[model samples]
Target chain A: MIIQVQDLVKRYGDFVAVDHLSFDVAPGEIFGLLGPNGAGKTTTIRVIMDILAPDEGEVTVLGQPPGRAKGQVGYLPEERGLYRNLKVLDTLVYLAELKGTPRGEARERGTALLERIRLEEWADRKVKDLSQGMQQRLQLVAAVIHDPEVLFLDEPFQGLDPVNVERVKSLIAEWHQAGKTIVLSSHRMNLVEVLCDRVLLINRGRSVLYGPLAQIKQAHAPHSIRVHAADLPLDLPGVIQVQPDDGAFNLTLVEGVDPKGVLRELLDRDVDLRAFEVAPVPLEDIFLAVVQDEDESEEGVNGLA
Target chain B: MDWRKVWVVARHEYLHSVRRPGFIIMTAIVPLFGILVLFVGTFFAGQASRLGDFFVEQFDSTSQRIGVVDRSGYFTPILPEYRERFLLYEGESEAETALLAEEVTTVLVIGEDYLETGRVVAVTKGSGFGSAAVSDSGSVRGFFVDHLLAGQVDPALQRRAANPMSVEPRVVSSRGESQGEGAWGFVFTFVVPYVLSIFLVMTIFISSGYLLQSVAEEKESRVVEIVVSSVRPIELMSGKVIGLGAVGLTQVMVWMLSAVGFSSGAVALLAVVGAASIPARVLILGVVYYLLGYTLYAILMAGVGALGATSQESQQLAGIFSMFAAVPYMISGFLFANPNALLARILSFFPLTAPTMMMLRLPLAEVPWIDVAGSIILLLLSIPVALWAGGKLFRVGLLIYGKRPTLKEIWLILREG
Candidate 1:
């Protein structure tokens, strides 16, 4: 594992920002840290980067205590900011130098990275002179200027448009192909679904779901199928519920029943089936389901008390 | 501690701050203002002397002559110089008539009992208080001395009687070292150190203010997280303190050098401060105290600044320490009267007040070597402790946004550290 967090607990006074959170990121893979706003994603990343101390539990990076591998780890915080008075290239160089890169090499890499982001012309301009999108790109360059082996990017796509988001995604892909570990924290489920291999979904400082993205989706995959057929029977064998879905009828099977059985039964009833396919739940629906489940449970506990 | 990272941060901070428009303007303003004051002072001094000469020339004009009525019987002859401005009249009524006609600016009447009582009166142009003629009274007295002693004594003896004596005072220290002549030397002895101490305090505050502002900016702008991810909080704080200290030093050096370069008063000031009461040790001590004082305050302020949610709030939070720095100045009268007083000794040992208090005291009195060493040691020792506490506060505070920490929370943070 490139990054390992175990039983991590952090609090800000009365507020528990990260409560008994445990997860690990394998080396050379993209791991999504999925959470809603105020869901302890930023705080957890801060702890892993050694930017904040955990009130309890332990975090290790590169098989060492947090912060021991300083130059090897990179972080782009959720709240993006840079020295507005500094030139674009200079800011990147300074940040790189702080991570132990010498000035000459840092500047060279900074220049190259600026070119990669198409900000080479703005290299000599002050950061304040750059527009918001330009600054965000420059900030991303700053994160990777030192070429660290492991990176933690919090909400890296928050302020980006689709085109820029695709640009950043491609950049991440290039790094991933180069065998770097990435812990990407974002509330953007669509991006996470497209990019993440493994994920840790957290809600209110506690883990909601954790594992390989495929396994979690497989485990939470509803036993349902969508059928685009005429005169579909509302009460089909082994089907518990049916609902209209985007010009198709979604049929929910019994808990132990397979969608193949329902499909065969549909064919046996001689339904004019135009289309039939298993419906895979989107990560967004799963995220909403898990979060709402946690909220309803907490409310029940509160009412009992 | 990574010295390399610290150096990088320090260098970046120094360059960034020094290039700021605010910093450049502030740095230039001090020396520029000093030069302006020097030129204006010299111009006014020259104009004042020229105005004095003009007034004398005007008073000596024929239209503004003095009428002297000699009623005393002993008067045989008036001197040649006295004849230039004074016209002897036979009676007071005649002199009074010349005064009313504006032919004379003043009229002097000698009483008949001059030998016994030496009574004389002056009559001038107006009947109100401004009519009394006292501006050129010294010349009139000189005239009296020249005439009175004319044939009574030898010329040299008469000259001696007229001018009296000239006193040249030289101070000798307890060690029998000579502090060069006159009251100006003694005045410089107190004034120079007092002024330098004020400069030291101002520089420390200004520099520490830069540190505060720098920390506040990083926090407010949300850049600190990225920076701190590469460097330790202590390293960041140390770098900023060292860097901004240099900035303050640069500012003070420019002002001091400009003072020495641009004005004759500063040259005379150095001469008196150096040749008279102040020894060279004061300058060395001044630099040492400034470094220690700046580090101590800068670290404390870095913590306080990080705790604030905004730069303006940080400045407001810093006001308490600012007032504390002024304590020595507030009680400066006692310091001047008794540099080795108990209160002065107490302030000298305190880290916050020590720099200014000791600067004021060093030139004024023979401060014991133990106190000097102790104060410096105390100041030097307080810095690391401040760095520890401040670094902790700064570490957590940088990540805290939107809300300023409460007193209890700050205390908790300190305790946690």
Candidate 2:
């Protein structure tokens, strides 16, 4: 584990922000911490970055405590900030230097990053003059200029246009390919599903789910399937549910039955099947299901479930 | 605290401050206004002096109109010189118009038992009454009074009473260099230090508040977080304080140089405007006191700024420190009258008021070396404490969001550390 957070707990007075959270981010993997707003995502990231101390926990980044390894880690805080009056390149270089890069190398890396972001033309422009999307891109460049062993980004995709979003996603992917550990926090489940190999779902400051993304989805086993046919009767064996609309039928198989077997049975019945696909459960559905499960469990404890 | 990182933050702050048009205007305009006021005042003063000399050279005869309401039979007797300057009138109404129309400069009204009871009255527009314009309506009134008084008094008695006793004073210093003196030296020594001290206090207070406001701007903009993440809070605060102090020092230097140049030019223009010697020790003390004073105030301002969650709050916080900075100037008014008083001594020993009060007393040579040393020691001791407290407050307050901290909360934070 390149970054390890063991039962991390942080509280403000009587309000707990992170409760007994444990996770490990392997080297060279893009890990995501998915949660809704005020779900301890930023707090977790701040803990890992050593910007805030956990009340009772151990956080080791790059084989050292967070404070000792600050320079070895790069962090892009949720609250995006840059010196508005400073030139783009200067701001990038300053951030690079802050991470222990030499001035000459910082400038070189800053210019290269600016070029990569397609903002070289704005090298001398004040950050306040840049469009919001462009400024977000600049902030990303600042974060990654030093190329730390681990990167912690919170809401890095905020304020980004689609094109720039793709640019950043690809950049994160590239960083992962280069064997750098990444822990990304976002409310956008779709983006996380596309980029993250593993995820930790947190709700109300407690982990509701944590595992490989694929395994988690497989375990959730949502009740929706895709079916395509020229004609279909209302009754069908093992077809416990069906909703026909938008020129497609969504079916749910009965207990202990394969969706593919149902499709095969439909074909054998001489039905003209155009397409048969077992619709994969989206991460969003899994997130909602897990969060709702936790809420229900709490309601059960309160005798209101 | 890494000095290099601090230097980076300092360099950035310095460049940003110097680049600001407001900062540039403040740096230049303050000294420029000082020089402009000095020039305008000196010009009017020169004009007034030249007019005085011209009046003294051109005017030879002096007179006044007096209204007398004597109801006694005794005739008045006076010296020829005194009689020549008085013009008695019969009624107050005629005297008022004559005085208004520049016909007479004065009117003397003497009522009942004029000589036996020695009752007499005189009124005049004082000196330089009608010098701007000359009229001949009351020109011979004093000459007629002199002839009438001569007919009433003995000629021998008038000459004896005309002249009276007069005395001249002398002074002796330790160096046995007794120099003739005038009110000019007293005014120069008393007023210049008081004025300069006020100027210094105002300059230091205003410049330090500018520093605080600048820090608040960066904090409000979230730039301080980025800077402090690399450099320690103490380094950042020190850099800002030092940078602004340098800017202030630059302004003071400019003002001093301009003052020197202006004075030399003024001396050449008017030979009678003597060169006032400023003691070497006073000059040295001024610089030392300015640095100490600025540092003391700057650190306090930085501490106040740390608790300020927004620019507006920071501005209001700075106002409180500005009042403290103005205390010394406020007390200097009383110092002028009693430079060596117990109050002045106590205030001069206090680090906050020491700079301005001691500076005020420097020209008078009233501040002892021990008092100066004590003030310097106290100020020096307080600076590090202030800086440390400010750094602590800044470190904790920088990341605190939402509400600005109250006094109790700030005290709690300080005690926690």
Candidate 3:
């Protein structure tokens, strides 16, 4: 593992921002730090980046303490900012130099990054003068300019336009392929679901669920069947609940019922069915279910108090 | 520590700040401002001297219903010019009555033995009173000289009898050498010291103000986090101070060098005002004090900026330190003349007022090297402790938004860190 966080806890006065949280990122894997607003994802990223210190437990980046691996780690904070008064290229070069790259090499890499983003003409232009998409591209260049071994990106796609979002997604994919360990945190669950190898989901400073995305999906997989039936009441003996969805009825299956057996029962009813499909639960459903459960449980506790 | 990074940050700051329009205007004007002020002052002085003459010319009168109390008849043969302006009377009572009755606006009393004693007292009714030395032929003194000594005495003696002698003093040294006693002694002893003291304090305070502003701007704009994550807090703080110090040094050098190189009038003015004796050692010390003082204040300002939620609030908090910088300058009037006064000496040892207080005293008296060195060493030594505590505050507060740390909290943070 390139990064390991064990039982990390951080508190500010009466508020605990991160509570006994533990997670790890293997070398060259894209790990998604998943959470709602104020769920301690940014705080955890900050601790691991060494911008902040964890009050309890251990955090190691690149097999060393957070601060010792300074030059090897990069961070893109949730609230992004650059020197608006500085030229785009100058800002990048300065950031690169601060991360231990020499000025000459930094300039060259900065120029290359600018060209790749088609902002080479804006190299001499001030950051404030750039369009939002252009500035975000430059921000990305600044973050990864030094080729840090591990990159912590918080909401990296927040302000990006659709086309540029695709562009940024490709850049992140390319960087990941180049053997860089990346920790991405964003509200775009589908994107995270598509791109991340593993994820750690937290709520109210405590972990709700964490594991490889495939395994988490498998563990929470619900047995739901989608059927396109003509002239049908859409009720089957094995069905627990039925809801209409996009010209079809999606049925929740009862426990211990075989899908094959349900299909046989549907055929016996002589319903004219055009399509039958068993769909794995999407990540969006899982996120909502987990977060709603947390909210309801907290409300219950609040009522008790 | 990490001098390369320090240099990099310093170089960037210097390059950026020096290019600002405000810095440019200041750099271009500072040296010449002193000379410009001198020219302006000289012009005003000249105008004031001519003010009396101009008014006298404006009030020149042809009609005279005047009373002259000439008991010795010194004006028995008064010149026609004088007669037009005066009506002489032989008795003091008559002259007094005419004066009181408003028959004349003034009365001139010429005493007994007027030929031997050239004293004349003119009393006026509150108009044209201080133009006593306007000794033209139309003047009262010229009238007395022309009337009393027409071809009876030599012209030079008559001229001497009319006006006070003008003297230019020069002090002769024990080596039999003499020099013109200009106000240069006062200049070197008081004015120069005051300038240096204020200079030391202002440079430190103002340059550090710029540091405070830039740091606060970075923090507010959210660039500090990215920068801090890459570089250590100490490194960033050190770099900023070093960078801004270079900006200050560049400006001061430009002002000083331009004064020496371009403005000969400024040097002449200072020389004429008795500032020629200012020792080079004092100036060199000014430079040293600038570096140390700037470091001290810059670190403190950074600490304040870290703890403040915004630049304006940080500057408001930093204002108290600026007041500390001004303390010695504020007390300079009381302590400058008496360099070894107990209060002055006590203030000189204090780290807060030491640099400026030393600047004021170092030139006026024969200060021992130990005191000078001790004061500088003391200021230098205080910097590390300041940086240490300030670094703690910076680390703890840089990422915090919308909250300012209190003094007790800062102290506790210091203790823990």
In candidate 2, which residue ranges exceed 4 Å CA deviation? A69-72, A118-122, A145-149, A161-164, A170-180, A229-272, A302-305, B29-93, B102-195, B256-277, B345-365
- Model 2, B1-417: lDDT tens per residue? 666666666666666667778666756764575467556656776563353334444554443344343345233444345455554445677776677776676555556655465544544565645432323323334333444455567766543333222223333233554422333233334444445555566667766876787777777776665455445567778778877887677766665555455445444544434434333455567778888989888887877787787878988977876665566567766766777778778877777677767777776655666888888899899888887777778777777765798888888778874
Model 1: how far is B101 from its true place, Å? 11
Question: In model 3, what is the error at residue A213, expressed in angstroms?
Answer: 1.2
User: Which residue ranges in model 3 land beyond 4 Å of their true spot?
Assistant: A161-164, A231-249, A254-272, A277-284, A291-305, B31-197, B259-277, B335-340, B363-374, B406-412, B415-417
Give residue A144's lDDT in candidate 3 (0 to 100): 89
Question: Model 3: which residue pairs collide?
Answer: B184-B273, B184-B274
Q: Where's the lowest-lDDT run of ten residues in candidate 1 chain A?
A: A252-261
iRMS values for every prediction: 0.7, 2.5, 1.0
Could you report the Cα RMSD, in angstroms, for every candidate shown?
5.6, 6.4, 6.9
| The 10-residue segment with the lowest total lDDT in model 2 chain A | A221-230
Residue-wise lDDT of candidate 1 within B241-336, one digit each (tens)?
A: 888888888877775565445434533433333335444566578778888888888988998999999999998998887877788888888777
Superposed by TM-score, candidate 1 places the C-alpha of residue A295 at a distance from the truth, in angstroms, of 3.8
Q: Chain B TM-score of all predictions, in order?
A: 0.68, 0.73, 0.67
Off by over 4 Å in 1: A232-248, A256-271, A298-305, B21-162, B167-198, B251-278, B331-346, B363-371
The candidate, 1 or 2, that scores higher on DockQ is 1
Candidate 1 chain B minimal-lDDT segment of 10 residues: B266-275
Query: Among these predicted structures, which one has the highest DockQ?
Result: 1
* Top-lDDT candidate index: 1
lDDT of 2 by residue, A25-99 (tens): 998888999988999998888777666668998998878887666567787777767888889998888777766
